[model samples]
Target: MRTSRAGTSHTVLWAGWAALAAGAVLCVIGWYGVSGERFAERQLPYLASCTVPGAALIVAAAVLLAHGRDATAAARVEELYALLVAAEPPREEAEGERPVAGELVAVPGGTLFHRADCPLVAGKAEAGPVDEHGRAGLDPCPVCAPDV
Candidate 1:
């Protein structure tokens, strides 16, 4: 089975959080070793090493988290596009007559309905025809300004 984009995004997000937590813990341990009166001076070098690497890990984790969030957003947009494509009417209907007000075309997943010849409908692979009367909940497309 193929792994879903959402699943991958969640995994990346959680991994980033885990890395951040580990980095924080390491930084704390390093700080305690250097500052605590009970620790010997000889341990300072090792503690400094831990502190530097821990800071790097924290930075890496921040970048990973941001990447995961962007991936999730992109996945959502793709899913919406797929839904819109699935809602399109048959090819014959699309090629034939001009759509009336109640017969306006729209993507089922989208919020707005558009005229058959609307400029926005031109290169969108996911765009399809939907009846305004049947899809009563969809609003008019602001750009095309269909009478529906």
Candidate 2:
């Protein structure tokens, strides 16, 4: 079974947060070694090294989280594109289609209007775009609400 994009995104976010927590702990330990009266003076050099790598880990984690968000957005767009392609009517009916009517897609028995790429419109018959004056009774899809 393939993992969902949302699941992957959450995993990345959690990893980033773990790295940040680890970095904070390392920095605190390093600071304690350098400032505590109980720590020997000679131990300062070794403990100080922890803070540098801890800071680096925090930065790396932030970068990973940012990329994860970008990837999720890209995945959504790709899914939308696929839905649009599948919902398009066969070419024979498109030969005489009006220019304004080709922009949107809807189901035959549904009461909602949707953008051509809306996932809800997938596998539904195309009713073309909503008429500018005939949209009084139809509701916009909550997921991919078309700007009717």
Candidate 3:
């Protein structure tokens, strides 16, 4: 589903690029026509038929390309945010077993243990109370070393 959305964005970007290229070609043709003409009356048909439409296409292509890029960036941000939320442990578990003051804490996969009040673990979503078994392989945090 996400890939499909990304594909649509890519399609829009490609369409915009194609439009830009076509516009440039049309403008070039108009310029060529005007350059070969001797009188202003002879050049008027080329200006009316090609130059004005070409400029409009270029402007529309720019807007389309910008919108496509913005959509792609927004999708990427949402996907990353979802992954971050999923990686976090459930709040209910942390709520049921809150760590007391001076207790050792560490994130699920972290190698270091820290004091409950340590700045490193303060706002971490995955940080939880580390029991004796949990503390076995973990090293004390240098930033806020917990007394064993």
Candidate 4:
């Protein structure tokens, strides 16, 4: 099953409790049975067998918890980026300004603000740059920040 941080912590704690209980049971048995040997000496090998699986479960739980934490952190980072680039306050268009504004987007290079249908260069005061795609660079719109 998938384990989160709390799950891992719980697993580890339960394993510890089991170990304690097992030891205690063995101790009670020893005490009641009259014996001249160390409490665990009689059945140490059999008791030791459970340790391997218990330890493995604890480690797996810890790793899953760490992964969950990392995912959470990445989500927070994306949210902060969105907040950083909120739409500019409404304003009158300057005489020289273009009228294009792209929506905030996440790109491989950086956040882009534009429509996917139109290239970042389209809808600019100046002409779009000519390239293999002939897509224009984003224009500097007075109302919104378009890639120019």
Top model number, lDDT: 3
lDDT digits (tens) for residues 16-61 of candidate 1: 9988998998898778767764557766675768787789889989
Of candidate 4, the 10-residue stretch with the lowest lDDT total is 126-135
Give stretches of model 3 more than 4 Å off. Answer: 1-3, 88-100, 103-115, 121-148
Q: What TM-score would candidate 4 get against the native?
A: 0.31
The per-candidate count of clashes, in order, stands at 0, 0, 0, 9
Question: With candidate 4 superimposed using the best TM-score fit, by how many Å does residue 13's alpha carbon deviate from the native?
Answer: 15
In order, the Cα lDDT scores of the candidates are: 0.76, 0.70, 0.86, 0.45
**What TM-scores do the predictions have?**
0.54, 0.48, 0.65, 0.31
Tens-place lDDT per residue, model 3, 1-148, is 2856677889999999999998999899999999999999999999999998888889989998998998799778878887888796644445556666678889998999999889887766678888899999999999997898
Where model 4 places Cα greater than 4 Å from the true spot, the runs are 1-49, 89-148
Q: Note the residue pairs that clash in candidate 2.
A: none
Candidate 4 or 3, higher TM-score = 3
**Per-residue lDDT of candidate 4, residues 1-148 (tens digit):** 2225445555555555565565555545544443434566664544444444445545554565566566556556656666777757545447444432333322333323344224543434333223223233322333344344
Better of 1 and 4 by lDDT: 1
Candidate 3: pairs in clash: none
The order by descending TM-score is: 3, 1, 2, 4
